[model samples]
Target: MSLLKVRDLSIHFQSRQGILEAVRGISFDLERGQTLGVVGESGCGKSITNLAIMGLLSDNGQVHASEVTFEGLDLLKLREKQWQKIRGKEMAMIFQDPMSALNPSFTVGYQLEETLKIHEPQLTKVDREVRCLELLKQVGIPAPESRLSSYAHELSGGMSQRVMIAMAIACKPKLLIADEPTTALDVTIQDQILRLLKELQDAYNMAMIFVTHDLGVVAKVSDNIQVMYAGEIVESAPTRELIERPQHPYTRGLLRSLPGAKETAFRAPLTSIPGIVPALNARPLGCQFHPRCDFASEKCQHQPILTELRDEASTHLLRCHHPQEEVL
Candidate 1:
């Protein structure tokens, strides 16, 4: 059974510009010990989806979800006090930027200890301190005893990220939403972090939603992948299935644009879909991707419902009138 299930979730921000729909009716599931990668370009609502799931989006943002059930409990309907109990103990989030996420004034140890205290206030100071040091070591920080005493500024980018991960998993959450967890890290560091998370997930059997713009990263970590575009999922399939046989034009374009693809080198300067994403205040009348899609037809301008594309595979779904030439 799925540990976390999200169905038709929509998160909108009512701003001075207008009501911007950041996440528009997206859905996915995460099973125990599996990583579900939410992949998309910038401003495609990947982070917003994570925020909605974590219940961290601002008050200005309105969330509408058909259902957000974590372990069969309706997360959307939870009271603030109830959510507080569940937040650290059952679900935790590793945010995008560690520099901005961590407090400069407090030592990493204090923050991590506080995280545990919030959930299990019964812990003694010595116990919390010991637990904090242990968590730091588990995240692969060198000399974690000393590192815990160091402030956020005292750590390198990769080290700070590990601290953030330690803080997140302090209470051993059942599900971890890691948003661009290794975005600014070097390639080697990224691999290290990903491997660490994978190891921890296996050890704890924790489900994860790993969000990133890099398909390469998703290729390495994800058990399943959901491709988002213009606030909606354009394509979703098992990780290997999506990579080996992409069906949607957008998915195919993304695959083709990979740096090492031989066909990409032969294509016209590496084709990129033209036109900016449609304004959320005034979203296109039909398929959201139609504006940038080369295979758009008159039917595409008539609001095609996202539905099953392949009869053989129940898991793969897409929203496109004329899906690109199947590169399966």
Candidate 2:
């Protein structure tokens, strides 16, 4: 069985303007030791989808699903208490901003130990300290013992992120959700973090859900990729397949927008999608991407169901009235 199964999951938030659907019905399965990358522009619901799965959505947020099973347990049916037992121990998340995620008042060691205390209560203080050092070392923090006494503010952005990664994996979770974990770092630092995550995932044999806006970054780490738009998945396929043969217009636009996508000379202009993503409350009817799609037609006024391409066994899926045949 898949390690994680989500069927027709939707998320809505209560607001003064009325309920806003942040995530429309979306379904996907994840197997053990596999990496699934969710990519899209900001506010495309990539983060919100994973937040709902982690049971971390706000009280005003409502999650409905036909099925959300994790390790054979029904996630939608789990209570806060039940989730607390499974959350950090079984699965953990690395937030976009590590500085904000870490508490300023506490030393790094205290925070790391607190996680161990909550999740691995059987460990004695000495064991917890040893594990904490090991975690910091594992994440490549220099002088793990000394860094332990430093506060969040004392660490650099890269170091802070490393600390976050350490805490998230301290319990040796079976699944890891990295929600733009490298976004706040420099390009070099981002590359380092990505390599670190890949190594850790391999070492621990953990399934991962990596959420990011950078298709290039996702291409490096994901076994499969899901491109979301306007709270819905527009395309999904094996990483290489989707990268080389993107069918959805939005996916093509994203790829074309990447720097050096066209392999032009230095200082050449980059391609960009025409318009901004629509507000949730003001989203257009039918296909949400039609407004920005260059190839949109009258038929695009109606939403397209996600359909498989090539054959019944093909893994490439697309939700488009005019799926592209030519490779971008």
Candidate 3:
């Protein structure tokens, strides 16, 4: 059985402007030790989808799904108390900004130990301290013992992120949800974090749902990639396959917009999509991406359902009236 399964999951929020659909019906499955990358522009619902799965959505947010299961447990059906027991132990998340995620008042050691205190209560104080040191060391923090006493503000961006990783994985979770975890770091630091995550995932044999706007980052770590537009998945396929043969117009646009995506001159202009993602309350009627899609047609006025490609063996799925046939 799959480690995680989400079927027709939708998330909505009640607002003064009325209901705002943040995530439309979307479904996907993740197997043990597999990495699924959810890629899209900001406000495309990538983060919100995972937040709903983790049961961290606000009270005003309503999640409706035919099925949202993790290890055979119905995630949508789980109450807050039930979710607390599973979070951090069975599943954990690395937020986009480590600085905000970590409390400023507490030392790094205290935060790490608190996670263990709640999840692994059997461990004695000394054991917890040992484990905290081990975690800092595992994440490649220099002088693990000394760093323990340092507060969040004392650490560099990379170090703070490393600390966040340590806490998220302290309990050896079976699944990890990384929401733009490397967005705030420098390019070099981002590379280091990505490599570290890959190593840890391999070591723990954990499944991961990596959410990011960078296609390049996703290409490196994901086994499968899902391209989401405004609140909906536009395309999905094996990482290499999708990267090389993107079918949806939005998917192709994203690739073309990447720096050095094409073999153009050194200083040539980078391609960019024309418009921004629509506001939740002002979204267009049919295909949400149609407004920005260069190849949009009259047929695009009607929404397209996610459908598998013609090849019987291929797992490529697309939701487009005019799927691109050319390679990127």
State which candidate has the highest lDDT: 3
lDDT of 1 by residue, 208-268 (tens): 9999999999999998899998899989888988898887888887887666775544445
Quantify all predictions' global Cα lDDT against the true fold: 0.86, 0.93, 0.94
TM-score of every model? 0.95, 0.96, 0.97
Which runs in model 1 stand beyond 4 Å of their true positions? 264-268
Task: Let me know the TM-score candidate 1 reaches against the reference structure.
Answer: 0.95
Ranking by lDDT: 3, 2, 1
lDDT of 2 by residue, 1-328 (tens): 9999999999999999999999998999999899999999899999999999999999999999999999899999888999998898899999989989999999999999999999999999999999999999999999999999999999999999999999999998989999999988999999999999999999999999999988779999999999999999999999999998888999988888777754756778777899899999999988999999999999999999987886635598899999987968
lDDT of 3 by residue, 1-328 (tens): 9999999999999999999999998999999899999998888899999999899998999999999999999997787899999999999999989998999999999999999999999999999999999999999999999999999999999999999999999999999999999999999999999999999999999999999988889999999999998899999999999998998988888788777744866888878889788999999989999999889899989999999998736689999999988777
Pick by TM-score: which candidate is best?
3
Where does candidate 2 stray beyond 4 Å? 262-269, 312-314
List pairs with backbone clashes in candidate 2: none
User: CA shift at 206, candidate 2, in angstroms?
Assistant: 0.6
